[model samples]
Target chain A: MAFGIGSGIFFAHMPFLKLNGIPGTTYRVMPGLISKRLTNRLGINFQAESFGNNRQKGMDELDRVLDRGFPVGMLTSVYYLPYLPKAFRFHFNAHNLLIYGKQNGEYLVSDPVLDFTTTISPKDLERARFPKGVLAPNGRMYYPVSVPEKVDFNPAIKKAIRWSGFENIMTPPFLPFFGSRAINYMANKVAKYPTAMDERKAILFLGNIVRMQEEIGTGGAGFRFIYAAFLQQAAKRLDNPELSLLSKEMTGIGDQWRDFAFSAGRICKGRQAGNEDFKSIANLLMDIGDKESAFFHKLRKVKM
Target chain B: MKANEVPQDDSGVIGGKFTGLKYATDENGNYVEVQSIGWDAEITVLSQAWDEVNEQAKEALEKVKAGQWSTLAYHSTKCMMNEAMLSEYMDMSKAKVKEHLYNPAAFAALPAATKEKYAEVLNIDLNELLRAE
Candidate 1:
């Protein structure tokens, strides 16, 4: 599954990187990276371009691609996508959507977060594509020109798992903004929030953590459940019982991740859910960090 | 999570207009994709983040109203951006961005072309931007 092979599980709580004055806390890497990883694994021939400072060129290229009846993936600023529910449309610039066709000057869009496909006017699409800010897409459009047939899945699956292992567990711990170490690093930093910052700001940081974890298309727990589900499917396909066992454990861990979210929510909302405070919340993250480190370590050793 | 265990609570800020896809296991212990309406805890945290944005925007609006800062401060906060990002988006130096955001005089003295550029990037009309509200 793309979820496991995408190698996107990550953690960061950098005070330097500010998102609307809230300290940076992310659960994954850059957007669209999962599909990029999938394309690489599939050996698919894809053409992706960033039309910086040339909006019309990007639009013309998109029309040309769609005239050939190919769906194109576009990196956009979610805030400008009027088709999206507006209540939560922040200034995220890396949201990916598919543009399959143009009719009556509106581009037919298929966003992963939505249940049904939507349409965007050309002007709105241009704004979404060229919107400025951090991680701006610069009118990026990507589509696969060719996908090879008769490709084997075993090697791809193994390679992806190994890559995730290295990316998640084996990254050097000295770098405190990535991998299992970052999870621990955040856990430790979060414990100091109350003492280091104002109470309201500290709570806002916790709320930001939960928002970053569950927001968008992540299947909860910074994608632990999705990864578990991926492992289960891979187990059946590869006929490996060990992966299934790991999948079950991962599911349980995903449940723990949910526990962390719900408990943190209670604290943020000030609902007084059994005295669940910042220290306990930090402990929960520390626990998840330990389990994830162990899980990835075990995964690196599984004889695929 | 099992297929049936997928939360159907559509109580998020998105309301029920859209659904999110989540991965779950079926009765056969096989993986399946499930559509989730949303979850309450997720809603709580998400709303809190947005509320912070709204609060900061509200505070900046007050400052702009009091002539303490330029409308850029209010617009930047309302658009969920900060001084650095406003600079990055407008392609101006950080010092100028800070000056234009904090000093009404700097914002008033901006050239018409630069003001139009700011309006375009901020998704506001040139007239609305000139009105400083």
Candidate 2:
């Protein structure tokens, strides 16, 4: 997995978008952003391409890549990967994994969501790669066609820091559902769930938030830890002790996010006190939003 | 998020069980990457949350078997769409999609363009879509 130069860079800017009429919420990065950032920063020939609604063509491309000894990254729905435990299965179509090789009709998969590498039959893999939903994978995949023999980490880290900072702070507030504004937007909306929805529906909604934060791959805490890892790597690469200090601070912030998830989980299981209603949940989120806001503010001002 | 904290329980372990890398605190209390076995409490609730989704999908499939709903219902369930999302994908009104869910005969009478749209959105062959899955 590409850590420092991948999702880690976009950590603080990840947003939550709540549809006006839909019951679901999203806390994921938009597809293709990772490849875009990687390509730009690493100066590699990386392309995020889709197979144009043709399953057979997509499968052919996947095989062609594997034949070339290139591990192809694919977008897949979580529910169709039979190798996954039932407990971790969902209809989410944006889960990502890499197919590196095949043996005995089973593809070797490196799913970032999983703790270890696994194999899947081609039939089951096909079902996973083509599940229907918004932003359908349609056999979408990405890979770097060319990579420089030598690369510099310092400049790349600096670029990532600048882009991530700009994207988070400068995101248009009018969108109301993205960037920092999204945190408050979601918090306000969450505050009303207790009165607006029945007990069952309210619990479901809360459960969804926790799942978005903690489940479906790297829980929210994982993102923070990933970013901290990036900072630590960046610090070592650049020999910048300040960046090391920042990494520790980010780790602390990650702990806060974990704490929020734990609180939300308690509420979901009805283990919390009566006062831990929607308002309290919203308050917890607001606390997170505040800390993150301040963290990014300091991040943007850090001198390389 | 540390390696030591990665759960060892089987509840949310994805893709059969395997050990993977996790970040954990070292003796110095600083974070370092280490290999660890898998367990995630988040997956426990996540799996529980899907009960309602699976229930809805199963019910929709039953409607297909009973011939009260078209195979589109089953495909929609497979696609993890509710009526509103299906309506958006099929370009039909939500109420219209719900009506079709209850009246297979009416759905069968839909325009070719509408049927084709549903097939395309569901990523299924149009011919196969007309029949039961």
Q: For residues A171-281, what per-residue lDDT tens digits would candidate 2 score against the true structure? A: 676765665556667777778777776766666766676665555345346466767777777777788887788888777777776776676776766633243477887
Per-residue CA lDDT of model 1 for A113-159, tens digit only, reads: 77788899999999899977677889998999999987777788888
lDDT of 2 at B73: 79
lDDT of 2 by residue, B1-133 (tens): 5545655555333444544455655555466766444434365456547665666678888888888787877777765667766775566788999877678888889989888888876667789678764
lDDT, candidates in the order shown = 0.82, 0.68
Give the distance in Å from residue A283's predicted Cα in candidate 2 to where it truly belongs. Answer: 1.4
Q: Number of the top candidate by TM-score?
A: 1
Stretches of candidate 2 off by over 4 Å are A7-28, A104-106, A219-222, A271-276, B1-22, B34-41, B54-81, B84-100, B104-133
Q: Can you tell me the CAPRI class of model 1?
A: medium
